[model samples]
Target: MEVVRSKEFIADCSWGAKDLASMNGISTRLHWTKEPYKWHVNDGEEVFVVLDGKVEMFYRIGGAETSCILESGDIFYASVGTEHAAHPIGEARILVVEKEGSV
Candidate 1:
């Protein structure tokens, strides 16, 4: 129900990097130097776009772990059923729209 501009959001660039639509069930996340960890989707899918730095996203497909490195301007996504995780290979800024009602 609002607009976010990355170049202006002073505290967290990830929160303001994109203009997000108010979804039926949705949320957003911004990770900085908080922690180096992996994550997985419990229910729905999420679409992400890297604003800065680099992130390595891994997912298990066909019993194989597939990896992809996302950099600035890179747009990537994972579905609800995908067994995936992500960690900052280096420093990274990303915007994610996570499906609401999901863990």
Candidate 2:
């Protein structure tokens, strides 16, 4: 058993992550970042949860780009092949669940 104080978690490098769990090829991880991640499509679905601070999530639909700000406790779901990126408003902690080894 373990306890993680998500709000207190920060990484030494941007987008650094802590592996929380893995089950049947699905993984749950906690990530801390102050920089933006490059846009990419996941091979599988993704569940993104903002645990602390805020994030500006950018996504594309039909080659059109759009974005939304996600506050603490907000959740974003990305289906397979969904092109997206995450830009932290500042320092933020996020919990992400997705197929293992997905990008």
Candidate 3:
């Protein structure tokens, strides 16, 4: 038996349960989990699409909170200088996109 896994960022879900589709400047990540964590983006704009779960997309602005709920097919985007986070309420697969030069 043999098992192959991605050597990229931390993947909390099953390695074989998800497929990663990526190009030189863009990538799509898939996952299935009810667990949650905080994601940090150093700079640039980021977009997230919820594939199959309930999610709470939150952002912090000057000590206040702005948020939204994302279900299947729902998408959210965070522009530069906005600190945002997400929490999974159910199992899901998420897609994240970033501009080519926007690290």
Candidate 4:
């Protein structure tokens, strides 16, 4: 068994993460970031949860761009081939679940 205090978690670099659990080909991770991530489409589906702070999430739909702000406890689900990016309002902690080895 393992315990993680999300608010107290920090990483040496932006988007750095700690593995929390894995089953089959899926993994759960805690990520700390203060910078925006590059827009890209995941090969598989992804589940993103804001654990602390705020994030402005951007995504492309049919060549059009749209975004939304996510606060603590907000969840974002990205299906396969969904182009998306996440920009932290400041320092933020996020919980991510996706296929193992996906980026």
TM-score of each: 0.69, 0.98, 0.67, 0.98
Residue 43 accuracy (lDDT) in model 3: 65
**Cα lDDT over the full model 1:** 0.64
Candidate 2 C-alpha lDDT tens digits along 1-103:
8999999998889999999999999999999999999999998999999999999999999999999999999999999889999999989999999999999
Q: Can you tell me which runs of candidate 3 are displaced by over 4 Å?
A: 1-19, 99-103
Clashes of 2: 0
Worst 10 residues of 4 by lDDT: 1-10
Q: lDDT score of model 3?
A: 0.65
Model 1 lDDT tens row, 8-38: 3333532233334445667675444323445
lDDT of 1 at 2: 60
User: What is the lDDT, from 0 to 100, of the residue 56 in candidate 4?
Assistant: 100
Clashes of 3: 0
TM-score for candidate 2, residues paired by index: 0.98
lDDT of predicted model 2: 0.97
lDDT of 3 by residue, 1-103 (tens): 3343422324566321344555676655555556765655536777878766678888887878888889889988878877777787856567667654443
Model 1: pairs clashing at backbone N, Cα or C within 3 Å: 25-100
CA lDDT of each prediction against the hidden true structure: 0.64, 0.97, 0.65, 0.97
- Which ten residues in a row are the worst by lDDT in model 1? 10-19
